[model samples]
Structure formats: C-alpha cells, structure tokens
Target: MKVGLGLPISDPPSLLTWARRADAGPFTTMGLLDRIVYDNPEPLITLAAIAAATTRIRVQTEVLLAPLREPVLLAKQCATLDRISGGRLTLGIGVGARPEDYLAVGADYATRGRRVDEMMPVLRRIWSGQPHDDQVGPIGPAPTRVNGPELLFGGFVPAALKRVARWGDGYLSAVPVERTDPLFRMVEKEWGAAGRAGRARLVGQVNVALGPDSVVEDAKQTIGSYYASLAGTYDVHMVTTADQIRTTITGFADLGADEVMLYCWAHDPDQVDRLADLLA
Candidate 1:
C-alpha cells in the first residue's frame, strides 16, 4: 500500500518550507485541503508551487470544494496544475458541507450536490477537447493525462455515490479503514451498475499527529479549528508512539485501501522526517 502525506496549507514561509521537506521525504504523494471561509491557502495554487518544488511526489487536493468555484475556470486551473505537475495530480472533489463556505463563495449551499453532478460532465467535456458549444467548453490546453487528473469524489451519500459511479475515477474517504471497506464494496457495486469496467481507487485518510505526548493537544486543537463548522467533530488521532502508528497503518492496508494519506497535524517540517523514519 502506498503512503502519502497530507500537509497543512499554511502561510507562505512555513508552507513552502514544509512542502520542500515533504518533497524530499519518503512520501509518494503530497496533498492539501480546501476552504473558502478559513485562512487556509488555496489548494490548486499551492499545488502549483509544490509541483515546481518536487519531481516525484504526486500533488493532489484531498478534496477540492468543486461547487464553490465556477466549473470552467476550475477545470482550466486544474488542467494547468496537472501540466505543471507533470501529470502527478489526483483531483479529488466534493460538495463542501459547510454553509459558511458556500455563502462566502456566493454558491447555493442547498443545491451544491446537484451542481457537482452538473460540473463533472462539463469538466470532462472540457478535458476531452469536446465542448457542447463555443461558450461551454473545449477550453485551450488540455490536462497532462488527457482526461484531466485522476477524478475522485468524497462522501458516502447515495446521490454522491451515484455521481462517483457516473464520473469519478475513485473514492476518497477521510474515514477509518473499518468504515472504508464497506464503502469500497458499495462503490464497486455502483461502478458495475453504472457500467464502468474498472475498479475505482480507494484512498483512505487517517489524521495522525506523532511525536511527544505534548503535541497531542496541540494537534487536536489545530485539527478542530481547521474543521470548525465543517464537521460535527474533528478526529486527529494522537499516535503517541511509532509502534502505535505502524500498527494503525497496517490495519488500513489490511482493509484493502489502495493508498492511505496521513494527515500530519504538526507545524514543523522536521515532523516529516520523523514520520518518514518511523514508517521506514
């Protein structure tokens, strides 16, 4: 099972330093979260910076809030990022649940799920160099992989899963492996029902804050704030020791996750090396 790093999108000085460190680490991929009502850096633009600084690590958005942005422009920006990243982009998207995020972007919070359903086809149409009309798509430069980045969707809702079956390349679940297994099975059935021939990727996320016990509270607080108003509760696993984290990851691997991205809650870049050493 491949392991990726989910680094925080912080202020320039700190984020750049951490991005560079992650690039040089043993991580196979590096990703970020998105928010409109928060102070977090923009995922696509930050991904562009990461692509310039790294050669091997895949650059991804854990899940970009697709409904908040205009679909065409979002597609253009993502394609450009994919090009810049040398095709190392996995575009995970979702209808962000935060009402404030939708309001901030002037998007219809109630209709976001439906908007996402419409957005996918438009994105794919643009990426495939086939527009429905002159104003709609077939936008200039295409994505690096030809059909845009690896499209993945987040959420376990029935409608969301139907959208995945229709357009997504995989499922990005920010849940534990135990919860992910059944979802993967459902995804498989949905894919087959949708007439899709291939197996969708299952990317698992586990919030981990390793290091001394002192960092646990700080990690929880940071995660809590980041997820404030977005989720009912924020769960940042305080893996106090290397042995504990290793066992946790092995459990995820055993659950058949195609890849697992570890969301690091520490601010320092040295934490990257520490986790790498532990995983080594």
Candidate 2:
C-alpha cells in the first residue's frame, strides 16, 4: 500500500520542515489538515509552498472544509495549485464539524452538507470549463491534469459513504479498525451500484506514535485524546508499538485501503525520521 505523512498544521515552522522531510522520505504523498480561524495556516497556501519546494511527492488537503467557501473560487484555487504542482494535487474535502467556524465565516452550519452537495457539481463544471452562467469556456489555464485534481471525500458515517458514491473519486476513512471494516463494505457496495467499483480509491487515516517503552495507554492520553475530540466522539484509537505499525498497515492493505495517511502525534523532527524508518 502507498503510505503518506500528515503535516502538523498546529505548528507552522515544523510544518515546513516536515513537508521537506516527507518529500525526501519514502512517503508517496504528503497531506495537510484543514481549518479556518484555527491554529493552523491555510492548507492550499501551505501546499503551494510545498509544491514549489518538492518535485514529485503528491500534495493533498487531507480534508478541507468545503461548505465555508465559494465553490467557484475554491475551484480556481485548487486548479491553480494543481498546475503549480504539476498535477500532484489531490483535493480532499468534507463538511466541517465546528459550528462556530461556519458561523464565523458567515456560513450556515445546518445547511453546510447541502451546500457541499451543490458545490461539488459547480466546482466540477468550473474545472471542466463547459461554459456556465456569466462565464465563457472552461477556467484556465486549467489544472496540470486534464480532468483536474482528484477529489477525495472524507467522513466515516453512512451519509459520507453515500456522498462518495455520488460524487467523489474516493472515500477517506478516519476512524478506528472496527468502524473501518463496515464503512469500507458500505463504500464497496455503493461504488459498485454507482458503476464506480474498483475505480474509487480507499484511503484510511490512522494515528501513529512509535517508540520503545511506549505503551498504548500513553498514546491514548496524547494522540487518541486529540483525535477523539477532532472526531467529535469517543471511539477506539489504534495505538501500537513500532513493530505493530507495520502489522496494522498490512492489515489495512488487506482490507483494501489503497493508501494510509499517518497522523503522527510526535511533532519532533526526529519522530518524523523515526516513523519513516519504522515504515521503511
């Protein structure tokens, strides 16, 4: 399976350093987490910088909050980044959970999902340049890829699976092992019914913390706690030793995960190197 690294959006200095390291590492792709009016920097902008710095590593928004922005504008931005990245951009999007974020951005939280559904088509239309209201031809100079960047939708529930089946190139699973199997089956069924079976990518998000004398309980207190809050619910968080990391990844590969993005809790540069070594 292809492995990717997630940058720490909470720290700008470390984010840049990690981006460079990930580009040079064995990781097939590098991803940035998204949030607005949060602690992190803007994902697209940071990705643009990484694109300029690296030559081949695919850059992705692990998941961008789509309902908060104008679809056309976001399309333009993503297209521009894809061009700059030489077609290495994968746009992962989802409806954000924070109601305060939507309210702050003057977007209605209640209707964000509906807005996302509508926005997907508009974004595609803009990218394809099929001609729409008040615009002539397709948007230019167009993305580096003819079809524009790959769109990956993220969420763990049935509604999210349905959305992926309806309008996405893949589904991003960000839950624990128990939940993932069911969601993966749901995606497989839905994709087959949609005639997109075996065509859609399946990416699993796993939290990682590896070292000697490091117990699962330690990971639970640190990484697990953070992800639980982010996921907005308490669920099993996969905490394992360095050896177990490889085993878990293999299991996910067996489960049909095309790729696995590691959300590392240790922000130290050394931890990045250590994780790379363990994965290698």
Q: Per-residue alpha-carbon lDDT of model 2 for 1-280, expressed as tens digits? A: 8998777554577776887788888898888877775666789999999888888899999899999898878989999999889899999998877777787889999998889888988887777766646645666658876566998998866777888888888988888654688888898889888886456788988777665444334555645444444575545566556766777788789889999888765555565687788876
TM-score of each: 0.93, 0.90
Angstrom error of the Cα, residue 99, model 1: value is: 0.2
lDDT per residue for candidate 1 within 208-251, as digits (tens), equals 77767666666777777777665755443445567877876887
- Native-referenced Cα lDDT, model 2: 0.78
For model 2, name the residue pairs that clash. Answer: 129-138
Which residue pairs clash in candidate 1?
none
Q: Which stretches of candidate 2 lie over 4 Å from their true place?
A: 134-137, 211-240
